[model samples]
Each structure stands twice: as structure tokens, then as C-alpha cells.
Target chain A: MSLLWRNVFGQKTGDDSLAGFLGSIPLFAEMKPRDLRQLAALVHPRDYDDKETVFSEGDPGSGLYLIRNGRVKIFTRDSSGHEHEIAVLEAGDFFGETTLVSPAVRTASARTLEKSQLVGFFRADLLDCMEKNPRLALRLLFGLTRAMSERLHLADRELKRLHHALHELQAEGQD
Target chain B: MAESNGLTRGHVLLFFLVMTASIASGLAIFSSASRITELLHTATTGIVLPVLLALVLSFLLEPLVRLFERGPLTRTASIFLVFALVASGLYLAFSWLSPHWAEMWFSLRTDLPRYLGRGIALLKEAQARVQEIFPYIGGFDLPSRGRVLAERLFSHILAQTTGSALKIGGLMVLVPLFTFFFLRDGQKIVRASVGLVPNRYYEMAHDLAWLISRQLSQFVRGRITEAAIVGLVVGVGLSVTDIRYAPLLALFAGITNLVPYIGPIVGMIPGILIAMVDLGIGAQFWWIVVVYLLIAQVIVDNFILIPILISHVSNLHPLWVIIAIIMGGKLYGVLGMIIGVPVASILKIVIIEIRYYRQTFALPLGEFDS
Candidate 1:
């Protein structure tokens, strides 16, 4: 795609398309004008099929991923085989930024709700970004934390649900 | 973030301060191994024990905590119930084990010397006959340096841990106390933490906490499950093989397996070494090891651990895990390596949170108000 086209739109913005919406994604927000201009040099697009897991719960968290279009559902399964959906991250929502600092096993599995387009960064690229723009790196943390908070809430709910189920079972015999 | 909640210039300054502090501390700690040991020991004694207890408590007591939160117990009562359960379990286990352990100890003291003498004689005779069976096996002989090697390893660990000159007991009680408050006022703590940030950065803080907790929980819980499975598999396998000290070896395997990346290796070393050195069946021992490690690798790390962890964890690459393990080990030795993954993952979430905060606060500050 042409530079302006990709820039204005998702990757490059042409005049008529959805190019103007590029500013919202936290990943691209902190780029310098010159850097943003040069992004056309580096940006590559990836495609994922619907219901296909882009990443699993314990995959290598090597890098960050940007969801340019479509939706992703991040969920966790408990020991008793209960699966709890944590978040429905939509476009402009950036995921997987936790890989750079703690590329430990993944905490949740991510799968596409639909065919999706994403841009990703490996550890080296992220470190480079941190080196050049530390503020930008911090912003990435914020976005990642949002996703995490969502999951914590889910864990809290899960704990509560287990309690509720047990209580209901106990009351059932009494009733 | 809405333009209404733009970050002021002070917010920008605070950002600079945090970044500099994190970077400076990183550099300082990186400069000295001794300092790193001090740092690590500080955390292990301080944070690790409470976090571990809290985690186990959370798991074991979640049901009770919920009951207390809901009805007559309320949240605090539920906490008490959880404690009650924990205390009961500990009491039961100790009572159960104490009588047997005392008996074992008395018998062990009495019989070990005699067993050693007999074992030595058998080994000596076996060594003489080994040459007749296979010339190459006869030359290898028993390891003479085993005691020295063990003493060295223990001394090395002691030097780092004790040499730091830090009074471990007096150093810090913040971890347990902090963990206590965390368990009690986790909500308030999170709120107060997130509340410090201006409204502009709230989303980031929220997200970061979510991600960090999830990753930490997944890793910790997975390791627990992984350890249990490894211990069970190895314990069962050895018992089935008619290996001596099956229970002890199994316990050792389970405990060591918590060290991840290096865990299985640490667990295997003693098992394999025992088989080779004492059993006197080198080829068979080596074959047993291959089969043992392969099965363990499949059942625990691969089939069991990966699935359980991945269900809720951020997909992390194995290379990164190894790197984290190495860095953690280098920084804090065993404890660091043990806690490395979750800590590292949490830090990543924090970093991401910091970034999102700047965006919410910074971008709006620069924008011209309508």
C-alpha cells in the first residue's frame, strides 16, 4: 500500500478511506512526526483466521501485537474446567505488550472473533522503542495493565461463583 | 482518555522521575553480584514466603472466603475460616508425620552406620567383579569427589546468602505485612494505587493490574500443578521400578520442579546420579534416565503444564522464559529464578500501564482546549 494510504487508513491512509482513525492506537500515538513518516518503511500486515488462536495461554510472550482491525477474546480456564472470558479487545486495542519485560508463559489465550489484521513487534524492536521513546514504552504498559485488570476482575468473579455454587448446593438439601 | 482529564506538567515530571528511578536502580543492581544477593535474599525472606502463603491460602480458602463474604461469616469471618482450615491441615500433617519421623530418625541413626558398612562391602566386591564383565566399566569406578563437590555447592550458596552481612530476620517484614494487608484490603490497595494516577491514566492502571495478576497467578498456579504432576509421575515411576527412597526422591522432585526451566534438571540430577553411582548399572541407569526425563518432559512441561498455564497466561516464548530464568538467577540466584517469570511479567504490565498513563495524561495536556 502507498505511504499516505496506509498512514491515513489502518496501515497507510489514502484520502477517501478510513485513514484518519490511525491516531487512537496507543502504540502509534507516541511516534514522532518523522518516525511516523518512516513507519511506512517498517509496517507489515498479518492476517488471522476467525476462531484461530493467535496465541495460546502459555506461548512465548516475546513481543507486542497491535490489533488494527477486528476483535479478540482473551479468556482463562480454571482447574475445574470453567472457562471465563476476560475481555473483548476491539480495534485500536493493543495486546501482548507484556512479552518484553516478562516473556514468561502466557496468562491467557487470544483468539480472533473474526478475521483480523495485526502488527506485531519482537523483543528487540520493543527494546529499541523503549530506548528511543521511554514514554511511549510506558504507555504500552498502561494498555497492557488494562487487559490485566480485566482478568483480575474475572478471577474475583470466578472465586465468588464457586462460593455461590457451594452455598446453593448446601441449601438445596435443606429446602 | 478524555481531553477533560489531561495530565498537567507535574505529571510529566513524575513520569521522568519513575523512569529514571527504575533505570538507575537497574544499573546499580547490575553492577554487583554481592549486592544482588543481598537484594534477592531480601525479597525471598520478605516477599516470597507471604506471597506463597497468600497464594496457597487463596486457593485453599477461596471457598471459605466466599462463604464469609456472602453470609454470616462475611469477608473477615471467611478469612478466619480459611486460617482455621490451614491450621487444621498443618496440625494434622505434623501430628501424622511426627510419630513416624521420630521413629524413622531413631532407627536411621541406629541402622545407617551398619547399612553403610554393608553397602561399602557390596560396592567393593561389585567393583572387583565389574572388570570381569566389562573392562571399560571397571576403570570408571565410583566418584571420589562427590562429598567435596556437595560441600562446595552448599558453601557457595551460603557465601552468597550469608556473606551479604544482612540480618535476614531483621531486614524487612513488609512482604508478609504487605501481603496481609493485600489479602485484607486488596481492593483498597488497588484502588489507592490506581487512585494516585489522575483519571486520565485510570484505564492503564486498571489494565496493568489485570494483566499482571493474571500472569502471576497463572505462572504460580501452573508451577504448583506442574510440581505436583512431576513429583507424582517420578514418585510413581520410581516406586514401580522398586527404587529405594521413592518417597524422598519424589518429594525432592516435586519441590525442585518449582524452579522452572532449571527445575526438571535440578530434580533429575540427584535421581540420575543416585541411579548411576549407587545402583551400579550404568547402561540401565542411563536408559532409565532417558525414559524418565522423556516421560516427565511429555506429561508435565508439555501436555499438562502448557495447557493449564496457556489457558489464562500471556503467550510467552520459551526462550524468554529461559532468559528470564538466567537473568533472575544471575540477579538473585535460586529465589530470583523461582519468582522471575511472574515478577518479570508483572513488570511488563506495569511498564505498559506507565505508557498508557502518559498517553491519557500527556496527549490531552498538549491538545488545545476547545
Candidate 2:
């Protein structure tokens, strides 16, 4: 009976499997082992075929998806219908973190590069976690805030570099 | 232009076919409603009601279980603890209230015929006085009509009571058993169900399920709390005012309050009738009882209980609520009337979400064209 239950619902106990995988992700790095187990219980594992769309660019974003195995391409289409590649994500990488705060439309689409396994952690799940364990919810939010701030710093440096290059190009032209 | 016209004609033909099929199915179901009701009363009651009750109980108790899980307990342990707590609470309440309930029941059984007789006599007197003024109202035989209506209602109640009594033992065993399983494995069950959706529609399907579940849980919790508060206030108010069978009246009022628009009025009828019988129509005490019921059920319930507890959960239009209650009553009697508003609200949500998804995607409705 226990074996059948495990086969049907998958093994949910023990911190060495899904909980460990979740802890390896930077976003959930701050969570304690017990907290990881709690969050792992809420994670929904999904499988996708190669070239299958995880979500369309304009689709409503609901949650973060962490790749457990295989590759996913995150891309957006131009106004004239040109697909521009943003990133190729593999195992341990997560996307759609912005939706944890609110359900907004996806700015980019994601599709599997190969047959893939993914784990979804939705906004509703997070809200429920907050009710059940506020401390864990606080740690998650802190991790999310840190990740966003790092991205912001990188973008600011890139913008400054671009501005300097434009000035140098103007100086050369004038000479 | 010719091709466009052909496409338009085909769309029109398809639309008409779909509409005709829907109407035919509706008519067929309507015609077979009596047979369906009979089957439901016999077989379905023994099976379906237990499952339904279990589902409602699990939804109501899930938050508490989650709360307990946050402590030093596993999910399974938390569920068991919740069950134990609820059982203990119910046992205590039963012990405390059982004697008072028995006394109330005995008095009500003894006083019912007198109340009915006096109520009929009062109605006959009113009919005569009205006829003296209007003359066209003569020969109405109001008492006989009232008696017939009363007889039908009594027989219906008796039949329903017998049916429910037979099923109580089964319900006692099944409801808790089903509830325990649901509380323990609800997440696994939901995940397994959602796991079957194709990758393309997975997120949409998941979101829709979550939305529907949230809506139902919120509505159920709010309704139960509102009913309890209304019952308590009405019970205490009547108890202080020399009213007979205050607890029984309050219980009826609480149960009836599950139905929207018409529930409070239905709840007040017996109280009003008893008051008239006891204090004589137009007496000061009778008028006070009438005013108190009005204030308790109408003013307090509408202004306080609904606004605080239920308004946000349902948010259904008054007209739609009335229509749903009437249709529900016509189909499934009192239970239908009670569930009518929530069911309508759910349908409204589904329709709105489907329309929104269709517009947002602009994909062909026939298949996942993208």
C-alpha cells in the first residue's frame, strides 16, 4: 500500500530529494530545511515535451517555474513578429519570480528545448504559506528582494557603459 | 467576398445547431426532473450527501489544519489534532445543550396545534372584516385554504424526516471518514487532477481551479459564521422578550437564513404566528415581538452580518439571487434554495473567466491552434 501510494502521488517526505533541490536554488537558499520541506510540499512537478510552450508571451503569469532537468528558452517577439532570444535556462534556474508578488502578464515566452521536468511554485501557494508560516514567507520575500536588487545594479552599470561609449563616439566624430 | 459570405453562413449554421442542442437538452432534463429527484432522494442521499457534507467540512477545516501544521506537527498529525479538537468541542456542546433542546422540543410539540388553530381563527376573522369593507372578498374560505396548505406542508415534513432518519447512521460513519481522507490527501488529489492537463492549458487550468476553490471556501466559511451570529442574536433577543420556543425559532431562522432574499421572511412567519396566538393580534406584547423579529432578522442581519461576513464573498446581484433561489426551490426544494446563490456565483465566475481567456488568447475555440 505504501509503495502504491508513493508511485501514485510521488514520495513527499524526507528532506533529501525535492526539499534539497529547492534549497539549492538561490531564491530558496535562505529557507531552513524544515521550511524547504514545507515549500516542497507545495511544489507541483510538471513535464513538458520538446518545443512545447510553457507559456505564451502575453499569457497571465501565475508563478515561478524551476527547471529540474532539461533546457528552456525564454524569448519575446518583436512588434513585427520576430522572436528575440533572452536566455536559455537549465536545471536549478527559475523564472517568473515577479509573479510571486502579483499576477501580471508574461513579458517573455518560455518553451522547452528538450523533454523537460519543471516544478511550479505559484502565488496562491506562497500566500497560503504566508498564512501558515510567516517566518518562511519573510525569508522568501527577502531572497526575492535581494535578487531584484542585484539585477538592478547590473542594469545600472550597463546603462552607464552605454552612455560612455556614445560620448566617446561623438568625440571621435567631431575630431 | 464570396468566400467570406460562405464562412459567415457556416458560422451561423453552427451557432443555430449548438443553440438547438442546448435547448433540447434543457427541456429533456426539465421533463425528467421528478424522476431525477426521486432517484436523488433514495440512492443519492445515502451516497452523495455524505460526500458533499465531507467536502464542505474539509474546506471549512483546511485552514485550521494548516494553522496546526505550523506548530510541531506533521500534516497528518495536524489533521488528526483538528479532528480531535472538533470532536471534543461538539461533545461538550451536545452535553450542555441536549437537555434544553429536549425541553424546547417537548413544549413545541405540545403547543403547535394550539398555535395553528388560533392562527387560522385570526386569519378567518381578518378575512371577514376585509370582506365587510370590500364586499368582493366574500366566500374566499381562507381557513379551509390555510388548512389544506398546512396539511400538505406537514406531510412533506414528515416524509422528509423519515427519509433523513434512516440515513443518519450512514451519514455519521461516512461524513467523518470522507472528511479525514479529504483533509489528509486533498493536495495530492488536486495535484493528480491538474497533472492530467496538457502543457498548453496547464497554467490556465491550475489558476481556474485555485480561484474556484478559494471562492467556495470563503463563501462557505462566511455563510456559516453569519448564520451562527444571526441565530445567537435572535435567540437571545427572543428569550428576553417572553417568547415561547425561542431556541427552536432561532434554529429555524438560522437554517433558513442560508437562502438569500426570502429566508428571513420565511423564518419570521412562525414567530409572528405564535406571537399572535399568545398575545392576541394587535396587543402591545405581540407588536413588540413582531418589531423585535423585524429588527433582529432584517436590520441587524442586513446591516451587520451580511456586510461584514457575506457581502464580499458572494457579491451577487439582488435580482440574480432571487431568480437563482426561485429556480433552485422549484428544482430541489429547500436545499436548492440554500445553495442557489453560491452555484450561480460559481457559474458567473466560470463564464467570465472563459470569456476572458478566449479574448486574451484569440486562439481558435475548436482546438489549440497555436
Candidate 3:
């Protein structure tokens, strides 16, 4: 009877449980255990075969996915139609966080490098959570905002470095 | 170029075959609709209606359960608490309203024949006036025609009423049991069902299910709320005017109001008929009742309750709404009419999302990989 209850409610308590894994994610690190459990209930766990396309460039993105196991390659195509590998993400890495805040097209494609497990937390789920549990929704939105801010700062530094390199190249041409 | 031309021709042929198959299937289904409806109706009445009703109940009660869960209660505790509260509330409401309801029912039983006679006479008088205007038109036996029509209508209504009463009695036991299970294990059920989708479409399917469920929940909750408010307002308005059987008429109004566009007008008929019969057609009180019903059902309900509760829930075109209601009435009667709009809305969402997903994700990994 207890086993049935646990299975139905997903009340498994341990580091291996979905709520535990969700809690360990940096984005959800500050959330309460109860909130984490509630959020876990809304997520979908999926398995992908090797070389499976998760999403393609220009596809409408709807959610953030946390890698549970195996590796995923994020890449994009230039005008010349050459694939540029952006990052190879392993288990525990999360992507597609931007779509949580607004509807957007994926600027890059994601494909699995090996047999992989992923947990998706969609915008629809977030919106529903906002309606039912605004406090939990606020915590999630705050976490997403912080993560995006950090990424923006990193992008800013990279852009400054590229600008400096371009300046040096122009000076050399002038000489 | 030759190979590309062959590939294009093959694609065109495939498309043609698919379209032809689709059209043929659609025609077959349309032709066999009556048989399908019979099968569906039997299945629905036997077991499915209870489950469907329970599902709707669970959806309506979910927010309250969630609210309870926000406190110190576990989900199981919350569900039980909600059940207890609902049961108690129903008990109280029944106890308080039963006497008034009984009186109204008794009055309606006694007065129904007179009202019918008056209504038929009014119709006959109008027919005579029309014939007088058009002398070429021949007279028919109005009383016999009216009697036959009334008999048929009443018998049908009685059959439906008896069936519904039996279902409602069964529902007393089944609904709570089903609702409890649904509330307790709904997430697990959804997860297990979604788990069946192949990996290629898993995310899209998951998102679609969530989106659809949210829309359905919003729509069901909104419509019920709108109905309750409209019913209460009409009841109060009628009571203020001291109309006969106001509670019964209000209940009728509330139930009919679930069907969009045609419902409010249908709801107004019983009240107007009662007023006309009791107070005579030219009585000032009859006009007052007409004005009050118009205000309650039309001006207040359409302007206030619908915009507030249901406007954002469904954005169906008026033409589609009418067509859905008519088709629903044709297929499943009153239940069909009530559910038609939401079902149509769900189909619209499914088509749009499927098309969007297909457009966005049709490109194969091999195309890029190669």
C-alpha cells in the first residue's frame, strides 16, 4: 500500500529522486523542498537515442531541459551552412532557459551525443504554477532571471575581448 | 536535375494519395454518423458519462485542492478535506432548498396543463390572423396538431428526465469515488500517458497535453462560474417581482445557459410563458417579467458575467459556435450542445499546435549532419 502511494505521488525521498535532482540544479538551488517537489510534479522525463535531434535551429522553444545522463551537443549554422558547435553539455547542465520567460525561436539546435535522459520544465507549466502557486512561480522566475543575468555578463566580456582584437587588427592594417 | 524532378513527382503522388485517403475516410465517417452516435451514446450512458462527469468535477475542484495543499496539508489530506467540505455544503443547500423546491414542483405540476393550453391558443390565434391576411392559405386542425406535438415533446422530455435522474443517482456514489482517485493520482496518470510518446515527439506531446489541459480547466471553471452567477441573478430578479416558481425557472435558466448563443433565449421562454399565462398577455406584470428576464439573461449575463469569466477562456468565432451547437444538438442532444464549443476549441488548438510543431521540427538531423 505504501509502495503504491509512493509510486502514485512520486514521494520517493533520496538523492536519486526527481525532486532531489531538481534541487541540486543551480537554478533551483534556493527553492524550498516542497516547492521543488511541486515543480518536479510538473516536469516531463524523456529518453533520447544517440544522434537524436532534440530541437533544431529556428524551432519554437517552449522549455528548459535538464540533462539527467549522457552528453548533448548544441550547435548552430552560419549563412554558408556550416555547423558550428556551440557547446557539448553533460549531465546536470541545463539549456533553453530563455523560453521560460518568453516565447522565442531556438537560435541553435540540440542533439544527443549518446543515449540520454532529459527532464523538461515548460513555459506552460510555469504559467500554470503561477496561477496555482504564485510564490513558487516567483522563486522560479527569480532564479531564471539571475541565471540569465550571469550569462549576459559573460557574453558582455566575450564581446569586449573580440572588440579589442578587432581594434588591434585595424591598427596593424593602418601601419 | 532528373533525379530532383523524379523526387518531386514522388512527393506529389504521395500527397495526392494522402489527401484522397483522408477525404474518403471523412466521407465514410460522415455517412455512418448515426451508427457511431448510437454506439457512442450507449457507451456514454452505461459507464463513460459517470467517468466524464467525475473528470469535470475533479477539474472544477482542483484549484480548491491546490489551495488546501498550500497549507500544512498533504495532497491526500487536501483532497479529503475538499470532499468533506463539498458534501457538507451540498447537504446544507439541499436541506434549506428542498421545501421550496417541492412547493415549486407541485405548483408546476398543477399549472402545466393550463399554461400549455394558453400557449397553444395563442399560437392558434396568431395562425388565424395570418390566414385572414392571406385568404389563399387553407386551414388545418390546429388543436390536433398542437396536441400531437405536445405529446411527443412531453414523452421525449419524460424519457430524458428519467434517464438523467437514474444517472444522477448513480453519480452520487461513482462521482466522488472517481473524483478522489483522479485528484490523488492525476499527475501520475498524465506522466504515464505522456511516457508512451516516442522520443521524437515526446516534448511536443508533453507540451501539447499541458496546454490543452490548462485551456480545458480554464474553460470549464469559467463556464460554471458564469452559469452560477447568471442563475443566481435571474433567481433574485424573479423573486423580487414575486414570479411563480422562480427557483425552478432559475435552475432551468442556469442549465440552459451552458449552451452558448441559443441558451439565454431558451432560458427566457419558461419565465415569459408562466407570466403570460398567469397574469394574462396584456397585464403590466407580464411586461415587467419580460423586461426583467431580458435584463437578467441578456443585458447582465452577456455584458457582465460572460466577458468577466469566459471571454478569455475561448476565442471561438460566432459562426463556429453556432455550428458546433447545432451539430452537437443533432448528435448528442442537450449534453452535446453544452460541450460542443469547448470540444471545437480543443480541436482548433490541437490542429494549430500540430501544424506549428511540424513546421518547426520537420528538418531531419541527417540533413544538417550530412
Candidate 4:
């Protein structure tokens, strides 16, 4: 697995090849090849060893990091110093999406669960590209909007389930 | 473990060696750049000034380009449209204002000595009043000394400008070309510059560049807005008072307004000189103009435009600003002074980024490990 990871990262990355990777991610999926190539120009490939931090909780988030290969764990530590797992993100998954729109501190820490290759897309470059090429920017924005709405819907469902369970427990206790 | 310990020491030693060597070479390169700027200023003001002017002009006009982008125009088209608009506006303004400008220049040349004489007389009268109050300081010949100093300073600025006017005119033609390309392909230019950053530091470099660019844009936009308001107010006010060279003085005020704190004072000099010439000493109108200028400058610049328009864009301290202006002026003349604030802010950002990078990447050793 490590050798494969090394070989994948070691291969020469053409702009089109990078664009292909970005196209799989929903946030950039809607962009045409030409537009994707322009967007891909902003991505910086980074490698991490197993358990190495990508970013820490409360760090000022500056960009999104997409896992090109291997897995990453997103977690937070509570006051008692116990870690709560948020999500185990894999290849094709991108985190820190919130920073693309605005600069805000990270709510959770990201660490490589195994040796990984990631690509960073900075907020600065994203905003710059959007300004220069608004047509492409619109497409990317539409994709991001869809992704966000889906998340919101999922969250709403979770809230409804939790509320339903609370009502059931209350009724039983009252009886 | 011993091998790792030796390697760490070797790394530390190598770091210090590289740091010292880089600093020394950096200073050497800086001096060479300063020398080249001086040479370019003297030999090819046409080339240098156009590029410099275009840079500043692009910064000022970026918002217009962005505005047109919202209206379904491509970036290049928007840039061209903005340039065309500016060109027509300038031509119209020049046609109307040219005659007045020429007449003002003629009057200034012919009446300059008379103005200087009156200024000297006014100074003498003030000196007499001061000496009467404090007789021990009576021997000070401030009036003649001040006249000589003012004459020298005025002539120096005039000489510098006149010497470069022909070259500057030629340069102005090229400014639109430079500005057009800058507004159109500025992002490509910036993105290409990312190649200069090493892989490990690429993200930080890209982020810093954007951060600086945004801050500078805000600063330049705010300054231009402030300058326009102040210039209009000062011009109209002075013209209303029948002051000579109202437009020219107003233009000076607007340009110098880019400099902080001392800028308004420097800008007020020509207006005050005109007042001294037109109304003479002890004249109620002269005092009125002086009072009006003081009130206008204080009220408009300090009380209004700065707070409302230019609200801490660079976030530079007053002391650092003064120092930066001085250093910039010494290095690159007027242009340096104008850009000092933005440059200083960029340096500040670079330092902050370095600190952040260090904190993030530095070895996280336990207290016992070190």
C-alpha cells in the first residue's frame, strides 16, 4: 500500500491529470475540463506519514485539503482530553470546505490515518480564480451550494430522529 | 539516538550559516536594486514611470473592472471598456481645463517674484511683532532666511518636475497599454509567480500573496476616494476665495494625501503661499483663508474621510508609517513614499506567515526531549 501510494505521488502530474482528480470531488465536479485545468493550477500536492497532522483543532483554516490517496481521521478533543471521532475521510473526500468561502478556525483536527497524499486548494487562489473567471466560478459555486444543502438536509433528518426518540422516552417515563 | 542528536545539531548549525549568508546577500541585492532604480529614473523615466503609473492606476481601477465583470463581460472586455471610459473623460477634462491650466502657469511664472517679495514682507512684519514681545530674540533675521529657504524648495520641486515633464508625457501614452494588460491577465501573472515558491512553502506563499494583494487593493481604493473628496472640497473652497492655482494646488493635495500625517501639511504649502501672495500679511482675508484651510483639513481629512473611507486598511502604527515613508523616500523618491504603507504591511504579513509556519512544522518535542 505504501509503495503504491509512493508511486502514485511520484508520477508526473499533468494539469489534466490533476483536473481529473478534482472532477471526482463534487465541489469541483461541475466544471468543464478547461475550467478544471485552470482550477487545478491552484492545487498543491502534499504528502503525510501515518498519524501526522494535516491541521489541528482551533487552527485558523486557510484552505481545503482533499485526500488524493489513503485515509484521514477528523476528530476533536473534549476538556477531559478524550478524542471524539468526527469522520474517517478517504480518497476522493475533501475537508475544510468551510474555509473556501471564509477564513474561520477549524472545529476539528485532521490527521492522516495512514500514509497519504493530499492536494490543497487555498481560499486565496479560489477567490482569485472566481474573480478572474466568474463563469467557471458560478459552476463551482453551484456545486458547493448543492453539497451544502445536502449536508443541511442530512442534519435536519438527524435532528428529527433525536427529537422523536426523546419524545418516546418522555412518554414512557410519564406512564 | 546519538546519530539523531548529532544530526539535529548539524541541522541547527546549517540553518544559522544559511541565514547569515542570505541576509548579507539580501542586503547586497537591495543596494543594487536601489542603484538600478536611480539609473532608470534618470535614463528612462518613460519606461519606468509608465510601468509604475500603470501599477498604481490598475490598483485604482480594479473595482471598475470587477463591476463590469458582473454585467456579462469578459475580464479583458471589461478592462478595455473601463480604459475607454477613462480616456474619454480625461480628454474632455483636458480640453476644458487646459486653457485655464496654461494661463495659471503663465501667471505663476510672471508673478512668482512679486509673490515672494510679499511673502518676505509678511514674514518681516511677523518677526517685528514677535520681537516686540520678546526683545531678546530681536536679532534673528527670520524673514530673509525664510524667503531664501522657500524660494530654494519651490524651485527644487519645480526643477525636478520640469526636467522630467517631457519623458513623463511620453510615458503616459504607454500607461494605458500596461494598465490594460495588467487588469486583463493579472491573475495569470500572479499564478505564474507561484513557480517561484518552493514546494514545501508554496501554500503559505500563495496565501500571503493573496492576502497582501487584497489589503493593498482596499488601501489604494480607500486612498483614491479620500483624495478625490479632499481635492474637490479644497479646490472649490480656494476658488471661491479667489485663490490662485486652485486646481493645481488641489491636485497636489490629492496626490500628497497618499502620504500620512505630514501629507496634508505638505499639500497646504502651495495654498498658503498663494494666500500669502494674494492677501499679504495682517489682511483679514489672508487669515480667513488660513482659518478656513485649517478647519477644512482638520474637519474633512481627520474627522470624516479617514474614519469613514480609510478605516485602518493597512493597520500600520503612526511611528512605523513615518519611518516607512522616510525610508521609502530615501530609497525610491516619491513613488517609494507613496507605496511605503502597503510594502510595510506586506512585510508584516510575511513575518506573521513565517511565525505561523514555524509553529506548525517545528518538531513537537516534550520538555524532556530537548
**What TM-score does each of the candidates earn?**
0.46, 0.83, 0.82, 0.72
Model 1 chain B weakest 10-residue run by lDDT: B361-370
Q: Residues B45-115, candidate 3, lDDT per residue (tens digit)?
A: 65665677788899899999999987789889999999999999999999998998878776776677777
* Model 2 clashing residue pairs (backbone): none
List runs of model 3 lying over 4 Å from the truth: A1-15, A31-39, A133-135, B1-41, B139-143, B155-165, B282-289, B312-323, B345-370
lDDT values for all models = 0.60, 0.80, 0.81, 0.76
Best by DockQ: 2
lDDT of residue B13 for candidate 1: 94
Task: Itemize residue pairs with steric clashes in candidate 3.
Answer: none
The DockQ of predicted model 2 stands at: 0.41
Model 2, span B1-370: residue lDDT tens: 5666567777889989999999999999987997888877787645656887798899889989998888889889999999999999999999999998889776776677777778788888888889889998686788989978876776676577668777787788999999999999987898789879987777777776776667677777888788777777777777776668888888888888777667777887897788667766565466546554666767777788777776453567889989999897786677778777767976776666567655665532323224
Q: What is the DockQ of each candidate?
A: 0.01, 0.41, 0.32, 0.19
How good is the docking of model 4, by CAPRI class?
Answer: incorrect
Report, for candidate 1, the interface RMSD.
17.0
Greater TM-score among 3 and 4 belongs to 3
Clashing pairs in 4: none
Judged by lDDT against the true structure, how good is candidate 2?
A: 0.80
RMSD of each candidate relative to the true structure: 23.6, 6.5, 6.8, 8.6
lDDT of 3 at B252: 81
Instruction: Go through the candidates in order and give the clash count of each.
Output: 51, 0, 0, 0
